[model samples]
Target: MLTISRTLSLPESELVERFLRADGPGGQHVNRTESAVELRFDVAHSPTLPEAVRERLLARRDRRLTDDGVLVIQGRRFLRPGAQSR
Candidate 1:
């Protein structure tokens, strides 16, 4: 389960995650490993979200929010093999 706040939590079943190969220039293993992550949350029909919160989230004008009320967040800043960490 994902805890959003003191009163809100989303079940694992309600969240969808996808891993993909990171884009852009990188080391040799970049194309071979799926280092990027995409997280999707369905706000329109989530049973855990309060109606007010759902409405507020959907009402926003964000590019990551789809017309179907699915919020998508992506992460791709993965450190390549043998690369030094900052």
Candidate 2:
């Protein structure tokens, strides 16, 4: 990974938010893990995203997109918040 901080022109504090959940292929174990990571970015309000990035995100027809235009990314790898890694 290219230094996570250096690779980003914006600071970590500026990132909208990151949600980690358990993604699965582990069968019964899948329900007990939260290894999936979802990135929740508010295209209309995140100060960290460049204008181009914002435009592109909003253009997507995602189920997570609210009528007001908030993008909701869910880490569905695990049904719960804590478990084993994927």
Q: Which candidate wins on TM-score?
A: 1
Expressed as tens digits, the lDDT of each residue in 1-86 for candidate 1 is: 99888888899999999999889866777689888999999999898889999999999999999999999999987565667654
Q: Point to the candidate with the largest lDDT.
A: 1
After superposition, which runs of candidate 2 have C-alpha atoms over 4 Å from their true positions?
1-39, 77-86
Q: How well does candidate 2 match the true structure in TM-score terms?
A: 0.44
Model 1: residues >4 Å from true position, as ranges? Answer: 84-86
lDDT of 2 by residue, 5-83 (tens): 5544645554455545454556665555556666544568777666887788789888898877776666553234444
Q: lDDT for every model?
A: 0.89, 0.61
Q: How much is 25 displaced in model 2, in angstroms?
A: 14
Model 1 TM-score is 0.88
